[model samples]
Target: TVLYYDDEMLLELKSVVISNCAVGHGGRVIIPTEIKEGKLIIAVLQGEVTVLNTLGERAAKNNMVA
Candidate 1:
């Protein structure tokens, strides 16, 4: 769920496959262009990250030589 601070609402994208995630400049979560075309940005403030597999782990796995 992506939170919009402007309206204080949560937007959820269902059945969307996340192709890739990486650490962007200033430690932001960089969503690949193929996924959302740099449209949405989800920010996590004042709370713990609770995703099944984090972006860091996914980025590491993607960078690994298979």
Candidate 2:
């Protein structure tokens, strides 16, 4: 699952992908450590892939439009 956090709220999103990156792929969750420079850094617990908690430019643009 991806932990989505902003200034207002924290949301737990399961089986999500952002910026062409997959979160909790193959049922493995990369443990989130901290947020830096608009990216949430995660540690590898049992997987080879690392995913970040980023909203991506497209999502940000959409949010701005909305």
Global lDDT of each model? Answer: 0.44, 0.40
lDDT of 2 at 37: 32
Best-fitting candidate, scored by lDDT: 1
- Alpha-carbon TM-score of each model against the true structure: 0.29, 0.18
Poorly placed runs, candidate 2 (over 4 Å) = 1-55
Residues 1-66 of candidate 2: C-alpha lDDT, one tens digit per residue: 233334333332223233333358576544434422343333333323344454464666677784
lDDT of 1 by residue, 1-66 (tens): 332222232233222334335767898666555554434545533333344643356666677868
Measured on C-alpha atoms, candidate 1 has an lDDT of 0.44
**Candidate 1 C-alpha RMSD relative to the actual structure:** 15.1
Q: How many residue pairs clash in each candidate?
A: 0, 0
